[model samples]
Target: MIERRLKALANGPELRAHLLDPHTEAHLEAYAGNIEYGLGTVKMPVGVAGPLRVRGLFAGGDYPLPLATTEAALVASYHRGALAINDAGGCTSVLIDEAVSRAPGFAFPSVRDSGEFVAWVLGQLETMKAVTGQTTRHGELKGMKVTIEGNHVYLILQFHTGDASGQNMVTLAAEAICQFILENSPVTPDYHFVEANLSGDKKASAQSFTSVRGRKVTTEVVLSRQIVEQRLQTTPERMTDYWRFSAMGGVLSGTMGVHGHYANGLAALYIATGQDAACVAESAVGTTRLELTPDGGLYATLTLPNLMLGTVGGGTGLPSQQACLNMMGLAGTGKVRALAEVAGGLILAGELSIIAALSAGHFARAHRKLGRERGQEDTDTSTGQGDQP
Candidate 1:
């Protein structure tokens, strides 16, 4: 891998005139190997594509999972996606964990903007725990969050859902919470309640937003519609079938391909970081959407809602893994999303390279002539000459 660094001695257009040369690059060598803070748990693969290793003080448990090559491609593709955006236009992406979900055996009640109502709900939660003979440690507790948008209030319930995304748990929690608020709170009974699960979807959703960028950054892919139509031997009208199989819940013409990019990047990062790779199965199945722009370019957006990738938790505090994380310059609490975003960007770049290769007809020929096979004919000729002599 080649690493390059640039520093501006002074501001303005003439700054390049005063730029340092390779001699200056030599003086900065000592600062090169210093590991970035908080990224001590990412083990890079040896070859161009190989197993990533992560070392850390991890609890003895089931945290290992085998990832497929296709999955790896998706991760690589998202990385490329990031590069594309960086080149085309400076864009920003904000990640929010708005999943108001829970575990199956837990329940939480929502409440309105009244101190008295909150007191009542707490009492009810305690009573419910007693009636069900359940404990929070045993995964029978409900989690809830409430946000204010102007005079309107929205409540979100989060459950420590086991295995599954815990959509049911969140739904139940939100409903119960809403019921509690309407009945006990001092606010009016006419407040609106929406049951839509918005966070984990592939397509963007609107709400009382906690975070957002100035411009929404979306990943778009353009595959010749004619080629797609030829691949499946179907008309454009049947593109919906392609969308269903490619990404569930996608509309006509196809589903979103962006999530495929996320899946690819995270798997590689997971393998490198010694994280629970299996979590990626659920992580990748999330929101994938495909649509078309007015100019006929296909757009894909994949938003993974439950990507529990961490930089400081689990195995991130180790040796070689730390070095790899240092190479990427990623660390800290809120930086996981930033890392994810970067990984997403890189995967997109990789995918674009892959797609372009296949489309350009060089994919097969590039690998066909490598290794001992390239010298097979020469070896055979040498053997024949020896026998004749």
Candidate 2:
């Protein structure tokens, strides 16, 4: 199979040998339904950053975080920022909101029918919630959003999912809710579907940005001027100025986030801990702020509105992924909120370091140094072809 793939790519013997190397002892069955023409597991470089501290509603104390990424200087930059945060007595993290939602739309023959359906749905809210409750013990119907068009109506069901990312959970709950609506609602629709495209599940849309999709979490830190100058090698004032400029740039560009490198930390963490890494689509959108304090300190905050994470289910049960989750004490129930806080803390560290490097004029220099090092690591001929017994 690998030989065929290599031939398809028009590659050489050496490349074929390299491709088969990582598969030698891997359990291909583990990925039974996950891949096609599977040869092996692709490896990612996971770096541990910080014995960083967090004071939060759920997460507290000091711990080392595992960040898996291929980007050069990502781990180092976040580490530097974490150290600075540690020096300033650590940071505080909090989970502010939680919900997982799906919108199912119904199109009727006329606007009056849509209105009747909407009115009926509103009246059956409690019954709808009860029907959804039968789907899962961990998921509870939280709320519903209603949208009306010319002859279409959308009912967005929201659920509070415990210890899971909730895409599947909410889908199940929505199914049960839909069944109830179908059986109970008086205004029958001309047509209906499970997803109305109003939920904004995975894509960039105004509804997701305006409301909660998964969990809305906020993490903040206060960097003392001494820590900033000593650890980040930049003045608090300069960092603040740069942050202001960056915020303006985001505004001018009309971007969803007003932050620096939230993806860097979140992506690495998500991959390491077996999260649905694609959820970073909505999870990565939020606000970051740099507030200047009178004592020359910097108050930094990163708020993630749709951080989809879980300590169980999905890829979390995979051995290596579970190990990574366990490393952060995130391998059991009641850890989802704490994990969100940790994610927020890491984002703060990453942003602080990148902002510092930008202010100190070392961004390019560090990349040049670390990136060349990465290139050399990739070239180390330590790989060998696999043999099936």
Candidate 3:
């Protein structure tokens, strides 16, 4: 059995027991699109952070966030940050921009043929938009960007997917559009492919970061100086100083974003919400900034450039995932922006916690206390450039 194979490879008896049983096939069927072979599931512990209040364009009020992760102190740290934000009236989140993107490629026998196709493509832009629009009820083809290299052309299609993530929607829409091109265009391409690798889907690339891939959410919070000192155990001035140094480190290290531990919260949040967990690769790339207020308080901002998420599709129909989504009032259409807002809120909470820990010089001590078991030595208690870079 696969369980036996896993046990042999992992060299452990624990896998033996866990793999022996899993959510029944009937239960798994809903979540798994294609169950080529049945293998058991790995379970991770889920933790709750917040009753962290949110003031967002879509999601408003207080709600506890469900973060599914096994990292020892992750939940605790975010929880502490949420407490601090809540103590300061809550985070103000906004889904600043929203779009779903896909890139399709075409190849021709020669440069002249490709140029003819490009001309034909430009001519058919209106018809192309009309044809793809027929594919989905909620989705609309927003725009198209063209790029060419030698005898090939790639079309980057952008869509407003409503409440669904729209990967499938875009794929189906692309197929319809491609078929139209193959049949209706005057110049026939020698070969064609659905994706040209330029779309930057499910990966961290400069294009996806700068342009919209999923949802671009930006959240801001103002913390009172008293709250900063009492809850975070640091002053606003010191935290801002650390942020400036960390920003430089991020730039020197060639990081896409200067945020602290964005992936930590995003991955956990994605899993809990039944979001396409792989989307976190592009979704978590963004910038974080802290400005010391004139009154000695702090103003913190988290801007996520590509937060690809959907509330009505993909793994969301699964019962357990549905339940988790329900907890945050996000289980149907027209709620994705709300879900995105909450995600931005959580990101804010997470980044705040990490910087505060660094400023107080308790960065290593708290990890030592919460991250270990039994009497294991707390060896990794260093607050240095190593932690940031």
Candidate 4:
């Protein structure tokens, strides 16, 4: 029974020795600690364990681009940000709701020769029976962007990339477009590094000089009532004090790493999703802020600089990852963005929970209990009294 629980609780070998009955009980104890510390269920009311509002906010925050991570107190620090403000008063919280990316780029380059390129592209479209003339009119191509640099043009083809991440579909489209351009256009066309898998790793060779054509993919959020009263646990004044404390702790420290609230949670989620755990270093940095609205509500927002996540590719397409994706209702179109959003929401919630604990002066106590358990086990071993009572 303990082994089964341990398998459910942890994925790999680092959890090897610790995968015992006591540790599993300890994990449950931590949840109990939450109750003891006055952290209520997320479903509860204001000053509860959940967020006050279920909305989102994204002002003074940039796009959640693909980026790196830090080893410092990142997730914890983000939690600190939440705590600092929550202790002062109630505040609004914008949880990341969702994110997705589309690929295949454009059928042709946009440039000085754009007229010729478009004509050529149209010719190719005419040749392909798969080209749905009506589909183009729909919003499927709404986020499409194009750019040119000399002979090289980049296409950032984006559709609503539902749940499956659409990476392969985009790549196929891009490859077809590149073929058409090379055959029809007079200009020598090149492509970016392609490894069948667009890992976006720096090491791949180029088929052409690929230029970034699309906008930095992103999703926005706004927080109002649901975020207040619940997530932060305090009113406006307390929120201000929280930010003051955060300012002293290098809120903008790139080297310092991810905000504290996201660290453990993201690590666990990423592991569950089969994402490269090391990449959490990049996907974690974000812009965190707290503001007061005219309506007297405290608002908090966090925009991750990079969220290198995929829903259908890599591990996401693998059996376990696919199962997890399915469990989240993110198995198909538009679901990847939904996954990102849920991740954001959970991360924000974690921030609130961590902050609430710290402000109420229980974080240290929780850690102390964990340490005491370890210490007692050590004493038992030394005295040859290792048997469990």
Which candidate leads in lDDT?
A: 3
Which order, best to worst by lDDT? 3, 2, 4, 1
- lDDT of each residue in 275-382, candidate 2, tens digit only: 888988777788889988989898998888888889888878766688898888878799998888888888888889889889888787777766765553321111
- How accurate locally, in lDDT, is each candidate? 0.37, 0.80, 0.82, 0.41
Q: What's the distance in Å from true for residue 316, model 4?
A: 4.4
| CA RMSD of each candidate after superposition | 18.8, 6.3, 4.7, 13.6
lDDT of 4 at 169: 45
lDDT of 3: 0.82
Off by over 4 Å in 3: 1-17, 20-26, 32-34, 374-389
The Cα error of candidate 3 at residue 40, in Å, is: 3.5
lDDT (Cα, tens digit) per residue for candidate 1, span 1-389: 11222232224233333333343334344323433421112223321221112111221111121222332223222322333333333222334442333211111233334333444445565544332233222123344444443344433444443322233343454455555455654444344554533333222333313322111122233434443233212232333334444444333434333333355555666666544466554444334454544544334444444454555544454443444555555544434545544433343334433433344443343334222244532112111100110
Model 3, residue 323: distance off in Å is: 1.5
Q: Which segments of candidate 1 are over 4 A away from where they belong?
A: 1-83, 98-142, 145-262, 287-300, 350-389
Residue 50 CA displacement from its true place in model 2, Å: 0.9
Estimate TM-scores for all models. 0.41, 0.89, 0.89, 0.48
Task: Write candidate 3's Cα lDDT for 265-342 as tens digits.
Answer: 999988887888998888878899999888989999988878889998887776667888888778898899998888
